[model samples]
Target: MKTLTEHDIRSSFVNCSKGEAKRLPLPKQLADIDHWDALDFLGWFDLSAPDRSYLVAERGDEVIGVTLRSPSAKRGFLRRSMCSLCLTSHPGSGVSLMSARKAGRAGREGNSVGLYICADLDCSLYVRGKKQPAPGGRMEESLTVEQQIERTRGHLDAFLERLFV
Candidate 1:
């Protein structure tokens, strides 16, 4: 991953109108992010619009971005959920089900794809131990950190591929 600018991110969106992308709130302190090289994608929830979220990733030479939405009702707090991307288990509502509108005609017809992901969109950090989940949240794995990162990226790429279907 490489450091990206606001313009780069805004222009990378594939599933939303340019105007909507322009209005979408970016992650705060874009310039201050020190983990660019560690990220497979940039993802964040919109604080101003609770149901809205965004993700941007580099695929080959192009950067692809998508708009995602989460249900208004929160998930149950008593259940532990695992992120499909990083396979990290989080207690309670720490995992969220987020759906992205498909690109092209499918999207116009209200078609979308969903996945269970980290609520904070910090899969990269979690896989690398740069961030921690609740006590006993992380499962012990035989895979090394690099393997975990690769698995996470593979999951994300598969999700992104679904946007075009």
Candidate 2:
């Protein structure tokens, strides 16, 4: 991910309204984020508030952001579940189902799309072997690690694009 200024982040959203973007809280440590290039996507979730999550994904030279809402946080499930974007599994609390309303009129009418994802949205790190894949994920892809990273980003970007279309 490229280093984004406040304006870039607030203006890049494809699925949220301008007012919503303006009001959304930014990471308090924004100036201290030293490694923007190492990030595949920039995201954050509010643990205290639980229902809100935000993401800014890099698509070529452009950035696209979306605001997501989780139905509710289920604190205690015994089973491990896989994140659709990272293809990694974790204890129930490590992943969540987040829904983002569609862009423009569809969103105004309350239409949204949802998917299970890593609670922290660090798929870029997971796919690159920087972070571990879900507990049981196998190195089954014949592609090199670099290729896998690119593929994962492609899948993630495609999902984000759907919110706009």
Candidate 3:
């Protein structure tokens, strides 16, 4: 991943209207992101609308974006959930089911694709050890860090592919 501008991010959205895209809030401090190269995609939950989230990634030569929604339901504190992308386990509500509206006709028909993901949208950082989940939340894995990164990206790519199907 490379550093991206607000224009680049705003124009990459595939599932929302231009007006909506223009109005959608972007992550703060876009120019200050120090981990761009470590990211497979940029994802953030909207502060004003807690249920809303966004993700952007580069696929081949194109940058693609998607709007995601998460339910507001609470989870049991003793339960742990794993992100499907990075396979990192988080306690309680640390994992969320983020659903993105499908692109094209399916989206217009209210179709969406959902995946259990890190609630903070920090899968890249978690996998790279730049961030940590709760104590005892991380599982020991035989896969190397590089392998885990590749696996995470592969999972994200597959999820994005579902948007076009």
Off by over 4 Å in 3: none
TM-score of each: 0.96, 0.88, 0.97
Q: In candidate 1, what are the lDDT values of residues 3-120, reduced to their tens digit?
A: 9999999999989989999999999988899889999899987989998899999887889999999878887778999999999899878888999999988998999999999988
Best by TM-score: 3
Predicted candidate 3 versus true structure: per-residue lDDT over 24-74, tens digit per residue: 999987878988999999998789999999999988888999999999996
Give the TM-score (vs. native) of candidate 1.
0.96
Candidate 1, residue 102: the lDDT equals: 94
Predicted candidate 2 versus true structure: per-residue lDDT over 21-139, tens digit per residue? 99888876878988787677888876557799898877888888888887674757677877788677777677788899998898888898888888878777777767775556435
Q: Order of candidates by lDDT, top first? A: 3, 1, 2
Candidate 2 lDDT trough over 10 residues, lowest sum: 132-141
Shift of residue 87 alpha carbon in model 1, Å: 0.4
Clashes of 1: 0
Model 3, poorest ten-residue lDDT window?
132-141
Give the top-scoring candidate (lDDT).
3
